[model samples]
Target: MNFDKTELSDEELSRYSRQILLSDINYDGQLKLAQSHAVIFGLGGLGSPVSLYLAAAGVGKLTLVDFDSVDDSNLQRQIVHREANIGQAKVDSAKQNLQALNRHIQIATLNHSLDEAELLTLMESADIAIDCTDNFSSRFAINQACLQAKKPLVSGAAIRWEGQLTTYDFRQDNSPCYACLYKPGSHQELTCSQNGVLSPIVGMVGSMQSLEAVKALLGLPTLMGKLMILDGYTLQIRTLNLKKDTHCPVCQAQS
Candidate 1:
């Protein structure tokens, strides 16, 4: 549950009545979700579903950061953006769509690139950070910021027929950051623009990220320290244990 007591209005109660009926997430869990704030980076394929689901599920506030604009090619997997918004900034387009989905939720947009300090500053105010970026550089920066801010991070990635999802809860001493999994300069980044990802692959990963984010906010079990890999070609999903790197430059000192 959230630290402060958050009351749900009659309208909110009605809107979230379906989820509230779950045994695991009753009224209290809904309240906790309503009090949580999530910062999402990249408004592309993975971010589309993550932001939409979080807003519809009643996450109180969302800070959307993306420097790119919606493109004709993005419509293939970026469901949150429409053809009409092709020239508009991704963050602005996403914010508009999210507001339409849940008027009660607050949505903020950052349509420019963020440096290390800017990312850290944004993470400090967020309860959790969601990384839907497609590049390694962006992912590394987000990982470092979340680690320093001590905020949980729900990260998802997809390319071609493969996708991966994981969580790093910086509030925990044993949680492994993205750096623990991939050394900063060792791995090459893949992009859908070049590799061509299947639409549903990104959707699957993003949806799971939304679920993990809600679970993290409600103090429930999440994908923390576990990497969930999906092979869209064979439709096989596997979970692997993610260990902390003792020499990780990002989280080793914190540990």
Candidate 2:
């Protein structure tokens, strides 16, 4: 999906008037967002808000990827899917909802997983990639692809009253990849299904992912080299500086 127009239409200007009012994101910023493309993986809890806000915020193009079908259990946190879409593929459901939210944006859907090569090809035109995946394996794969592609990636995870958010802006020489923080197959993988997640926790993290994606596109400050940890139980947030892992196989090779 490509949006070639460099200017925002009157309708788009009105639709995103509030966002454009911000000094950091004036008309020029809104125009930039209107011409940007975002690729989102995993249309689940985090994806729900990320896609919704991006669409409503007037990102020109979006690529939604998810292979799972909507289940009854998903209605609680996956706000993008409705009860009627229970048996439908998540990407299809998300596309329907996102299109309905902002008809001006162009949206594409991929109802299957992508290999590293495929991921790189898909991200060729993407301004940013958002990782809403819950599993560590998917995170590791996405990180590697983004690193190779040299595209910015916004990564988020939430489970059991805890949430984490970060960005791996692979375009920068000093940006750290996800592998720098967690070694593959070393930390136990946790899922929302296995350990209950507070519905709002995902919403919070997903919303932040949307923010970071837009910031990255506009060349604004973001969590590019920082990790944010949220404790829903204590309602506390912590931000940690991330250093490039001198020994990280994934990023060290690129460096």
Model 2 lDDT tens row, 1-255: 245687888898889999999999999889889888999999999999999999988889999989999999999999999999999999999998888899998999998889888988988878899999988888888888888889999999999899999988888999989999999889988888989999999999999999999999999989977999999999999999999998999887777
**Which prediction has the highest lDDT against the true structure?**
2
What is the lDDT for 61 in model 2? 91
Model 1: runs farther than 4 Å from truth?
1-5
Candidate 2 global TM-score: 0.98
lDDT of 1 by residue, 1-255 (tens): 235645999999999999999989999888888888899998999999999999999998899999999989899999999988989999989998888889998898998899998998999988999999988999989999999999999999999999999999999989999999999789877778888989999999999999999988888899888999999999999999998988888776665
Candidate 2, residue 254: how far the Cα is off, in Å: 1.4
Model 1, residue 112: what's the lDDT? 88
